[model samples]
Target: MENIWEVSPLHRQVKSEGEMTDLYKIEIRDLARAFCGALFLALPLHYTMEMWARARAIPSFMLVVILVAAYLLNVGYCYYSNFKGRPARQVPWLDALESLGVGIVASTITLLLIDQVNAHMSFDVIMSCIALESVPTSFGASLAKSQLSAGNKEDDLTDGWATDKKKILACLLGGLMFAFNVGATAEPIVIATSINYGQLIGIVVFSLLVSYLMVFMTAFEKEKEDEGAVMGPQWAETLICYSVSLLASAALLFMFGYLTPTTPHNLAIPWVVVLGYATTLGGSAGRLII
Candidate 1:
């Protein structure tokens, strides 16, 4: 009788091809998710006047530093966040490079769409702008799997709505709840323009502390079980979610015309911080409940 443990050469070859095909599908899905995450998190910076202004002024060396820093951050995040539950072998450095490439491509395409990159701008300026924007986009790409994954039954509702769809709807509704009128009004701008540098910094620190407290530290809707499934440690998760809130705040404000190309960085940064406080609370709460 033929040995059950032994495989025929043709069978082995077919199995190898099947594995290769599965890996390709996983990689493609990962890339598509990365692109969506990059746009979701980094779109706000595309509208920030400060970002564009700083692009022209940023030193070439600093631009290089930003690129390297983004790659290193990607490596660390991708190590844990990419290819989850997949049979493929993990190569974090290679994944990091892929994330970085996605970031660069996403940034370039968005900048072009916004008319931010034109022939009149020097090549150095264009490159610097893209490099600066690429940092957040690459970070977003690296964190995509963790942040954008479909919700598990434990974390999602039992209703007929799909868990992933529910998760996304919850995020949008939560953000809109806090940011809608706030973005439409002049309060954020007034507060931003009125605050001194010290106060602005204090707002940022306070926002971070409050957001962390609301989502992670509090007993409100805390899920003790499956804590291991959550992405990153407490502090890191807090930081990432807070960053998302800030991005959301910026995008909302820009959409409302409160932050425009003519708006000064001095005001824009503070406006984002001020409005981000509310959005952060909503975002953290939204994710916590979901």
Candidate 2:
């Protein structure tokens, strides 16, 4: 479907004098939604101590990697999920790029207002922080369609593969939300636990098993008890969903400063696996809503 945020030629033809003003109004509304969505997700990370330290500590090359990854994810989401039913030509790549830009701008403005940036910091440091923080904010910005739209039409819904894809996206969002909530406060807990390899392995096994049961066995609604049966083969469905949750867990941990590039692989692996347990549960719960 053509982006609702975009003004079509038909809109421009409706009395020339007011056309520009109408278009401007639409653009303003889109920008406002984008900014609001970005802020909603970025604020927690903005205040995070680990995020601040990572911003200053991560190498320039890694900063570029994060920026590129964020951009690509935003673009893919825009194309496959956000603009799914729109005419391909109308869903311009520019919109995806622009959404990322909006996220970066919003993050920068927010950080500045919060006094996270000051003359004491070098220009590189400020940019690095803004860029690092923008990744999650950009993901939120790309979700503006679902995030901001309260009255989305029934026609926007999908079927078959698209439907499955939407579920996956929902899982990612749910996992991110759950992880962020705990991640903000869980660093101390993670440090205190510091489990051994055996315990870490147990956490990983428990996470997968619980996630599978949560999605398949727990009856959130009696009518939907068999919903998991329709997703695919039981094993494949569980594996795919669990993988998405694990990836989200790791990313959020890194983003929140629970995991860092400097940390040894052994330590980071266990932390991520342990946290993945919570995230997988959150992801399964997310699927239920969809």
Candidate 3:
């Protein structure tokens, strides 16, 4: 016969209540971190007019794509780079989903607090804006383990020569973060510089060169001991990383309205290259720290 105390309705009820309480506490802590992280990285775009306009103009289908991309990025960061202690392969899907939700919720709350969202705005406008902003916010939330945790070391000794895909994804996330922080301010600077065709070409060359040096030749602490052991030829790895940063730059330029479908190919190419300069630095820095 089972023990009366173990099988008792009152005891089971008490155990269930205790479990629920602990779960609530964990959730509350996660919420606090998510809000703080999201706000830290997202504050600039929260107030920018370009972001608001893009939010309205972005189609619903693209918005869904953004959310899905953000989710995958966050999951990759959370699972591979940030939560190193936990076996990411075994991590439940729900936790990743919750972090994504946290990003959206935190962005919504911050926008509301800043008076960006109000009853005066159409529901579609508000939702679209929140979804657009959530990309960076969610990425930041995904990085909470690295950014928000106490005494979290930036370098991981166990991070051997990571697979090319992981390294590229890290570069993309870092570049995106850097771009989100500066893309809004870049338009004015780009316009003011009046960068001519020659200068634009030079900028592209310079960005690629700098990106290569930063990753391979810099005096910065080594990220991987077997850095020279990448699967492909050295130039191939460099090109892959450079391409990721360039792609990130283009995406950010589009999101910030610096590039549009109507823009001529020749004109748009330079701006993307120029922005890639800053974004590559960010990507390299991200690889170092993350």
Candidate 4:
């Protein structure tokens, strides 16, 4: 009767009443940590390799239109899904792995696949940032869900529908993170192309991650999960996250392009220094400041 997508009853007992207030706080805290790790790893470890993905252009005009509709629709859907009293499930895998996969895919799409749309950005980098950002977010949100429960197994089956109002809101937030990121990243790429044909297969993967997060968060807790609405992390943590990203961007400038095959004059040079210095200012740094 148990499924991989459903969190076991044991895991639900992991948190106590005092934790309810921390649901949101935990989510924001983890988010900052994950992004920071990504920046530190991505900045210096693989910029040139990311740049090498020239996959070619394709028809994407229609696709662009669809994505725009989806972005708006999904944001609304996030709100709708929760209030509707839809079914919920649990899933395996820590939130970090989810985040890492997203970061890699976004990097790939931005560095290589976007060219498929005639070199136009079907989305803005912000969108990809959204997609990657949402991965672990679902897991973070779920902590709240799992910690708070409706009380007793006897009524959980039918009455659970009542929780939809709040659950749906959380779903919308998670979905918005994915849809916005996908559209935003693809927007710039799609604009360059006349048509918005299917994006590289990655969008599906991203969607799956988002969907998983919603159910995973819903079922992961045991004690009548509702903790996120209670507590929130300090803004200071958000600042640290942005700061780490800035440092990562600088590191990225130096580590990448050292081995590119471009011609001698065409090879990257002092541009690295300028980029190293410039990227830090507005890059992840801004995320922290805000």
Candidate 5:
């Protein structure tokens, strides 16, 4: 008693193959996005001398820890952000692994291209360099889910509901991204050393004004509504974020060995202010983007 309208096994097989093809295409597209994000944020680090030096000096155990931390970060980020541009899997380990792999691959290629690694280098050194570089790359790849998307909206209806804590975190992440480049370079120290107290004051004032304008003035009119204002008004938000950016700048500089107990506050404060300029802009932009 088979129905005349029954589908054939051949048709079901064709449908399955088509679905597989579509999934494959989605994977390829996500891979490209991950690669782009990795390079966009981490390329400057690849060129910085400090990163290379750190690679050689940091303990091998620490290098492995850094890589594992990056992978775990990717897992949490991908779970929340849908880095694949689709519903996240029940477990996001695959997405995290892919993100980590993209970072490692990008690091390897760029280090090789820049002559930071070669046959003459020891195996341990080479691995350490790649591992260290991949941390930022992997983080950037995770961020691509939210920041690099083409369909980000500007309407208040879409973003006005974000909590103050989320905004602050975004600012920190953004500040880190911008400061990462300058923190590792010698230019910030040089600028800090050359500038006078008056110039430093001017830089600090300018940084605050720029951060305010970037987050408030730059947004469209429709994007100003705030339904989640338990943390006070926009001005307070800007001040807090600006302060966070400065703190983050100092921390990053310390991590890069630019700040030490022997370094006088006279020099360290200016160094922070110099880098804070970039971090403030980044924090503001991050607030807007998120």
Candidate 6:
């Protein structure tokens, strides 16, 4: 009697070695393509594509650039992880930088466009988002690392090449998704009296939700709901992250004409926008330094 050649959920038919190899190849190819496509499709509505259209570089051309760059970045990042002997929760160069770098780069380009055309926001707006970029991006990245590391298959623990690449891809996708959603939803409004309390509330809520979902989906989606995590950065270290923003906000309000320079405000531009970003992202980078 012979065994049946039926396909399993993982796609390899439960049969010969050649068939399994073939199936794995196809899966990797498809996954790469899927990742590339999602990378473009998920770019936040505010920047990149919106401005790319302005560049008139042709969409297909940009696609080529993204595919090539992403493939190389993926491969290179994976190589380092191989020597590091740790899960991607702590791969310093790519995971955190990949997202944080994109956020800052995107913000610069977007604000430049706004200044030339709209000129609606003050210097503080860009600074604030840049600062916030640190926190929100790091927070988002950390969430992904913690959540994903907790849920990964034990077999893949030392399989550095495959595991790290997937983790990096997840972080990139997470950042891209965050940008796209925020771009579509972000008000980017200028405040006259003080920061919009409502807007801050919304940012807080949205950042939490976005970070949670992305971390859950890209990295830790497979983990049990009640499982506790031992990987990723420690929670205590994040105080520096918050502190950077607090001090920055305090300074900005005093110096930048953001606050009355006399009466105390609940949130300062430095805190929310600049220091906030530094602390949030800064501390994460500190952890990444290891």
Each candidate structure's TM-score, on Cα atoms with residue i matched to residue i, is: 0.54, 0.73, 0.78, 0.23, 0.78, 0.30
Clashes of each: 0, 2, 0, 51, 0, 13
Better of 3 and 4 by lDDT: 3
Backbone collision tally, model 3: 0
TM-score of 6: 0.30
lDDT of model 1, residue 283? 67
lDDT of 4 by residue, 1-290 (tens): 43312443422422323443233443444345434434433333123322222111212342344334334433332222211111332111233243434344534544354342233554644344334333323222222222222323331232344433333333333333322222222232333233222432233233333333322334434344332332223233223322332333322322222223352432232222223223323222222111
Q: Model 3: per-residue lDDT, tens digit, 39-127?
A: 67677778888787778887888788878877776766665444222232214244456667777898898889988899999999999
The order of the candidates by lDDT, greatest first, is 5, 3, 2, 1, 6, 4
Model 5 lDDT at residue 150? 65
- lDDT per residue for candidate 1 within 1-290, as digits (tens), equals 33212333322322233463344454466689889887776778788776677667667886776578568756755544552323233456777888889989999999999999989888998998888777767867765665687623332212455433333334443554446445645678888888899998888888789877876678985464333334456676667667777877887676544677788887788999999888877766666553
Candidate 6 segments exceeding 4 Å error: 1-19, 23-28, 31-151, 155-186, 189-235, 241-290
Q: What digit string (tens of lDDT, one per residue) describes model 6 on residues 1-290?
A: 23121223445433332344444554344233323322243334334332322223223343334334443433333332311112422243444344444434544554465453235644544454333323232223223322223333332332444432333343333333233232222122133134565756554544334333433434534442322232334222223224333443343233223345455444344234422332233322222221
Selected candidate, larger TM-score, 4 vs 6: 6
TM-score pick, better of 1 and 6: 1
Clashing residue pairs, backbone N/CA/C < 3 A, model 3: none
Report how far residue 141 has shifted in candidate 3, in Å.
0.8
Cα distance off (Å), candidate 6, residue 116: 20
- Candidate 2: clashing residue pairs, number: 2
- What does candidate 2's lDDT look like per residue over 177-236, in tens digits? 557556645663465366777877787788778877876677773554233434676667
Angstrom error at residue 273, model 4? 2.5
Best by lDDT: 5
Candidate 4 vs candidate 5, TM-score winner: 5
Q: Report residue 55 deviation for candidate 2 (angstroms).
A: 0.3
